[model samples]
Target: MTQPNILELAKQGDAKAIALLLNRQLQPKGITATAALKDGCLQVILEAVEVPSQQVLAAYMSKSIAGLGAASIEKVKVYGRQTGTKVPAWNQEFEMAGQKLPVADVSETRSAISTEVTESKPLSLKERAKLGDVEAIASLLNIPLRNKGISATASLQDGCLQVMLEGDPVPEEELAVRVVRRELTSLKAGAIASVKVYGQQVGEDFPAWNREFEIVAQTQTVKQNNNVKLNNHNHTLGDSIESDGLQEIAKNGDLNAIAILIQKSLAAYEVHVDAEIQYGVMLWLKLKSDKTLDSQACLNRVSRILNNIQPDKIVSARISQINSKNPKQQAWNKYLAFKEGQFIDNTKAVNQMTGAFCAAVVIVLIFISVMYKPTSTTSSSPASSSSTPASSSTSNSTTPRTFLGKSQTGYELWADKNCVYVKGMTEGDLARLNTDVWRFKDEVKLQTGYKCVLFE
Candidate 1:
């Protein structure tokens, strides 16, 4: 269809037609209706004319409004970060300063007020690199506790740490924000890493300043000692200890310490670990105790993370045994022993297990294919069958051959013989069909396949 006609149809709430027009216009420009939808103009139109918010569908159409209306947004100070329902499609009605407002309205208000504003906290090298401020983040690292006096500013240069004083004076402060990028296993001494100084202002008092530093670590840095001391004086495991400046503690089978350390390390960055740190801690304990499985730990961790984080961030992992003494292997061994004690042969059970494993593999492959598909298979496919049956002679002769598909009544599917039988009709189609409701004026006996046959 033409651009003007498409725009008109969109204004009339024909989402599919609007989408079609948008796609046609954007295809030549190497874009999709999804792209137009991202910019918000088309999406706002669709939403205003359409019934509900089509944000997800708008995203599908590529109509994103990134940084759109961000400048005029205001902050809605949340208490303890527990602002609203954590569930998706969740809604709550509450009184806000004596006015009742829906949670969705609150969310929309929040979004509109804080457009394009990121939640990046201020980090200063001078405060972090202080004599006792080991919690300071040189770049953008998370610290377990808050830095009360930590002060620094950062700026993105040719992508390196650049240090400056708070008052924009000299290079007195040696605290630098440096970015380091390397594989975890290859980290060693004398590695040149990329970094950035975040010299943004905080509150209304402090001016913008930057402090930069660089790590001398190199790729392929071997762990010479088992007791390694972290930069913040935290004693770590697998370190033999250092004699001069720092000390490392050694332990054997201390499950509590091991669990705590594993939890702390794993949970340090939420973005990195797929499993909860608590789960990691439990898994570590199970491994240390030579237990059969970490299922209990896994479930506990899942519960904790689910309670803590928003619904969108919840994730799961499927672990497999790579070692002979792997936990899963041990679990299977225990299961076999228990069954044997009960005088039951595990051969049949093992065969069933094998069948399940094969089925699981096939399911995983199919799931991956669907997830990685180029186009969305979740959306409705185009209708190929027309309602204008070639043999329906009593149907409105003057009306266009537009098909109004079947009508669904609960579990029962109903289709008018004249409309070629379909389920559920769109509002537009319903309105048109209502005008033709008088056409089947007389009752007629229909074949078993037909709802009712009309007699002239």
Candidate 2:
């Protein structure tokens, strides 16, 4: 009898069959594979006596399952761990269905796994660096980057590599970061999930600005440090700190210090009274009184800067803002929420609403101006209409008007209003009566008795 195809059986949600096929390829050098299908998503686990390389395992799985033509599997979530470890060190998810092929996820996954294959021996230097060996990685970077007059230091906190650069001309920030990322990636550093960079003058006491290069779909929650010295100041914001001065404190990842600097910025805006700063799983700022547009604007700008620079620290930001001193004034509670895989701030809704209201008013004014303009012709008194031009030559000199202006809107208008007598007219010309009237009022000072005769 012929044997059934492993790929076909695996597609039918046969976890054991998928595990067997994976194990056959993995070939057990103290390594093993297991799979479970959950909610139309196949999860594959890799365990080894020695920790396994997540990149190697994930790449192998993508090539294997993608070639299998498994339409039922919508996504594949891989978990890698040591044989005795309960929690997985490496975790990532990639799509699988309806694709010609699956490429390895280029985004690094968090783990402390070895390079090459899993063996009973000790891990290599590159593997150690992948597991957050700061000294090892820094030493490797020091040599290459030293000749460029850039000193490099790496710190791992909450799985983010904070690369502090002290150099001249502050090598282009993003380029600096990408080069660092590329270098570390080439060396297979798996622990550095994302990089937060701080650039400083070589001889300066502090960094002037800092930025954290964001990660694709990384967790937004920033882990808090219990070691920060919390302040217990009264309601009024203390000495307002300059935003530029806070850059270094923020770069140092000091939550309490950052909050203090934020308070200082608020103070400078004169909204210090009744301001409350709450920190923990989330950063919340409450402005109970004396909030002006300038105050709120400055606060929002500084807070957003902090959140963008250290998303891991300020994972979520919320504010209850009130511009008036009255305690009864309703406060606007705004939040930063995720939408379509990016953050959409609800606070800006107020600004957008104000802008839209102004736009609506302008539109209404334009509509009224158009609608109120007379669309039909007006008849003059019979006495004036019947007046015959006894001396048509005398009338020509009396009404010898100059061409003051002309207009075209689906019809032509030539105004000869030197004597406030608009001579050019047709049935359609009546539609432009309002425009001509306004121009005549300003330019020719047209009065109630001015006559406009039809020329056609």
Candidate 3:
């Protein structure tokens, strides 16, 4: 039957057909095959009368089974063994007179197994280093380094492994010692034999490995033995201690040593008795009085205080103003209000001055009206004479005297200053002239007794 028909039969779980087909294919090379269906997958086991190398046997089995075209076979396990041996032929073994022996005879055998088993089992420091395990080396170096918030990674290079460490910009000596101790415990010490260790901050592509030891070791002795002293006092801040302690004290509003330092620094100026910390670091110095003090001087005083207490902890400091309720600030506000009132008073004064000037102009116009006088006019009187005391006296006078008389067309008389000025007036021009003549005649009568004639 065709290969496709054999695969079809195997997929249907026909054990007999699958075994027959595999045997037919492998028997030519003195190999026997067995087929079993387990866990929904076809398992093939092969045996050889004359054992061959694993590579050769595996290749041969792979090719022969591929030729079978078994679609249902999910896993292929090719085991080669001599026709009578129970042990698999692929495993390393020693043979004496055709009898298999254990791998203990090879000296390097233990080391090779150590490399594989170390990943699963816990071993001593020396055993782990001998096996050249990357994880074990990293763990050993990181024990003390963790205190400095540093971590390391190991990779094998040439005969020695390289450990690349990363952490704070400032390196601590204790971290380096931990790394060196691990290296010494793992392997012998020599320029070529010792593991190479270097530190860098995160994001630094290249680290100065040659100078790293010198840089980290420079202050090692000093920093290790002592803590950072504040001012001339006995209080000290250790390298391992964080800035959180200082922040806590500041949050509680207790100036403590910080206040003492500031008070001494700014002895020339009046300093505030109380100080406050905002947002953890901003030191607010409350002033006792609102005097024009130098801002830079205050800043210098704050800087001196910080340098003594916790230099790196406080980012910035400044002098705070006195409260608004202070007497000095209230007086300053009153002065400003007085200036504003002066401006308003000046505006009102200007308005009153303008009104006075307008009143003077009106009074001057009235005075001119009261003082005005008009000149008299001369004209021939009518032939009809009326016998009256005032007219008889002015009969021979050539000057035309004003007379009170009715108009020929209209009943109207013109008079001025309580005296008759014109007679028989019919038009507006004659009437206006009559009124002026009357005023002049009245003035003449008052001065020389020349009276105006009144005609009925």
Candidate 4:
């Protein structure tokens, strides 16, 4: 008997029939596919002795849904766990049948499925949000935020998911980030600049791990917005500090150096620093400017320098000159985060700082990094590890931000210069096709939080 097309059933939100059809191949391997519709996502649960990895199952299912050619069915949530566990330990959201697969590794997903047999379980609110399910995202955030008496709305804009908190006694930017990062981890994000995610694992337990694989995909060079103006005043470039040296230290996650660099970099504008504080990825710089400047405009400059130095680092740089009457003296400044060569107007930055006169001192003392340069020399640029700053990074500033491409579909890869390249090189042979020399190799250890942001 000819079974109904899974795509059509999925589009109609018929979770049961879809599960029945999916179970045909899945069930034989001791993995049952039970699906349900939640917030427009088809939530598929796989229960077994042990759940398969989230990335692999999502990729496997992504290939399936994408091949079916259904536009109506846009989201899929696959959860895997022990056969009888109430909570699914494995869960990942797969944005499916679209121009791109949201899975971490496009090349791997495009390849054959893993031979390992595994099952899935129910999707949690956090998992549902990964597929751009607004309700799930909102529901997951609404409770805690409400308890804190903050009114907020969460949404997906331009492939980015963010939460907007309104009303009085707004939570500290650091606290807010903690909530977001801890609450909906599957929906983690940094700023975007034609960025794609790669090198992500299938899940906690799926076994198609190519412990020995490296992919470097590149595509056409593209131009981006360079709106921020740069004017070097007082012309003491080399005298201050080796911007290069400070940058090297910042790459090693020196929070102190990051603040000093920001202060010194803005000194040319007569923007004197007051207090600077960072809560997770959110950074607030309270300043006293003798010259009038728009908040966003100042942020644009800060964003540029930070991006130039850090590349893909996520720091919501809130440039606030206004001393809020609010007692806590929070950094209720306009939030502009640096990502992919620009300052993005991201979520509001919140923090507290006590400052008003450190710019002159900052500039004079900046060059002292020459004194603090670590004694041990490891030439590689630090991979954005917040914990161990000076470890495991192979590339430097020129390194093309390695993305295990969540947005990419194994169709194209490119440098920020938009230099395009194809993948056909052997396991170890690499050649520079573009004159803009970027570190290229066959291996990178991917992490969860900092450098490797796994998202679509």
Candidate 5:
């Protein structure tokens, strides 16, 4: 009469009896035997009937299990043992069975789940500084860091800003010095004061994400005012160059002016530049300094500005600077002497210089390529080219090329004429098409594509 009674009957291996009972069904239209079978009632019926493929009986066995009645089970808290240790265990109050329970008494196969209590060991700024968190170091100096109000969020730690978050979206162990550098750059540039550090906790199966605070050192307005006076003096000189022109400027190589300019540049702080760009620009600049131009934070800042202005232009300017004042003076004198010729076209001289340099480079490359010609001595060897066709054939036959939709197949990678054909398909053309397809797909998915590559 009831579902459980029917279940009991099915358990007794009554396929015919079960079918007969179902034939006398009295339930809603939405409920069906087939639905019950799909919902795993058929297996139960098979056991009851002691016969597999009693499809009709099994099919009729399923329906809303609410008819079977409610479960008797209720949640209970199994308490943990307290050892009265001094280390304040971070625990929280919990609720079970409509009753508040102390965390100490709550337990099961896993520790109690609840909100975090305050940390027992509050770190002093000095102690946090030793952890190499730069922001923490700044904090020790009484710097005020901005807080976004997310606990376990990243904050200042010490000499380096340490991300102390647990369970980050990214794996914690993969974090490296580059990340530290990036955060430091942001701190230096006043972008972010702190970040979340992610890591796994001891004796835990899952990772934890934690927040840290940022504290940066600040200069008193008075100090900034004094620096501004010196900055104004140097800035006037830079502005002077605009009106007076580079020609009228006397060349004493005023060390004081240069030093002031360098210092102000460092303090003024411009766009953020990463280490690689810093290194490359420094190499190209070939600065006349025993002062270690490659490093020194001032140069790093200047390099960032130079890069922002235009990396290629900066590189070209530096190359032009080689031979120091001699080439500069010569070029300036030549320009003055040949003022009429200079205006023939705006880029006439620069274009001539660039063309000359290109010609020289082409000559060198051609010489090297000829000397190292592929056929210079390799003709006697078995043609490696002969085996390429076989491998290509196998690749063509077995490659699991996916159609992957419109986003997978279209692009003009590089432009030219006449492309090599693959099985009557132009390989280069297809490659371009594939790149376009991927770009379109990435655009649709908000994903990055190789063809749509971006760099900073």
Candidate 6:
């Protein structure tokens, strides 16, 4: 019998037909199995040793039932039989055949699956960034900015940058304001044009508005030369230090030069100076006040001196009193979790395997079975004119409707008024296509994990 006839017979609860179909589908994938229609589901029993992971087996069964177009089959329950175990260790249910099956509440199974999936492939920085990786990006940004008393966190949403700086007992307002300004100015000219900076003292819900600033690409001009000069202003730090051309070096965007210049100028304050580039074109200068020095006073003096030296060249400049109590420690635990060349989405991997299996079944069945055709019956009637005109007359309109077609990648493609659908396509393939062919549309959720739809 043809594959369609066999599938139709299986729907009628013919055990032989169901077994034959299951064997035909599963055997080629190295899964020796038997199936029967029972209790409104396709009950599949697999040889324990032949069964792989539950997720892999679930995906295979889902794709197989979908291929058969068996709407009567509500779900698929898989059980594995081992030599010694009295009860099967592998028992899982998967929704199929248009049925709204309840999600399995197997927490232990899910936890084990998650651990297996995550440990198999840890995410790298580049891979995570491509997926808009939130945790990885935040960890990377926080690593360089960690210091005594102050901590910085970074988050990116839709390519917009948000940086939050927190200090215990709050830093001097003047210092916070300068730091926020410098950071924003530097980021505005980089690849990240939109930036929001927030500063808050530890234990506060709201940020200090006076210490906040925003920068957008449209309002800012890109500095062509890194050596742009800062405006000179009168300061209490004496003319001798001012005449040393510290402002000129700050304008050069040289972190080492800027750090040396600031250190020499503030040596009298007995502060420890450190500097680093926070982001593109933005430099961070940190000054730790000694016990004998008044932290707030030293911050004020540094802010005034730095603010005038490179006001225009610097994107932002801040001088803040680092919190003495419970300073936040920088730990890039997430970044460290990144293992190079080892990022894998378990779902996507399973989907690809399932798609390949389905595609193979489709190709094989197409060659073995005749294409299914609907039967049509007709009867001749005499004296149709005497009957009602409406009964005899037929409408001849043919509305345009979307139908499945073949894609270059061997996926089945269909487009409706709202979205484009594809079967046998993996998420990775969909992502690559989204960047090229499906650039303007977003993906729509699909009931079948093996299929994907892009919204028009």
**Candidate-wise lDDT, in order:** 0.27, 0.51, 0.42, 0.45, 0.27, 0.44
The Cα error of candidate 4 at residue 78, in Å, is 48
Clashes of 2: 3
Q: Which structure among the candidates has the greatest lDDT?
A: 2
Residue lDDT tens for model 5, 1-456: 112233343333333223323322311111111112221222121111011122222222222121122122112111111111122222212122233223221111112111211123354333444555454533322211112111122344333244532222333332221233223432343434444444555446655543333434322121132222212233332343222221111111222222223333443332111122233322122232222121323333333332211212012222111123322211110110112101111133544454455445446656885686444244544554344432233222333222122322332222112211112123233233422222233343442223332110
Model 1's number of clashes is 53
For model 2, where is the 10-residue window of minimal lDDT? 104-113
Please provide, for model 3 over 272-388, each residue's C-alpha lDDT reduced to its tens digit, 9 standing for 90 to 100: 434666677555555554555544445444543343233222344545444435522211100000121010112234334444543454455457645763323456345424454
In model 2, the Cα lDDT at residue 393 comes to: 19
Question: What TM-score does prediction 5 earn?
Answer: 0.17
RMSD of each: 30.0, 20.7, 42.8, 26.8, 29.5, 33.8
* Greater-TM-score candidate between 3 and 5: 3
Worst 10 residues of 6 by lDDT: 330-339
Q: Rank order by TM-score, top first?
A: 4, 2, 6, 3, 1, 5
Tens-place lDDT per residue, model 2, 263-357, is: 54444344432323356435565554553333345434454444333422334556655545555343455555423222346556544554455
Choose the strongest candidate by TM-score.
4
Off by over 4 Å in 1: 1-99, 102-149, 155-159, 163-193, 196-456
For every model in order, what is the number of clashing pairs? 53, 3, 0, 32, 48, 11
Candidate 6 residue-wise lDDT, 231-311, digit = tens? 233333435333443333353354544665666555555445667655453445566543334433344344444543443
Model 3 stretches with alpha carbons more than 4 Å out: 1-254, 323-456
Candidate 1 per-residue lDDT, tens place, 1-456, comes to 112232333434333334344433322222222112222223312211012223333332222122122221111111111111122232211111322222222111333223322223342222233222222222222210012123433233343433222323322222212111111111222222344333433343543543334443321111222322212224432231111101100011122222333333323112111122234322212222232233333323323222121111112222221123432222211011111011122333544554455445446656875686554244434442335454342232333333333233221132343533222222233233321222211111121245443211
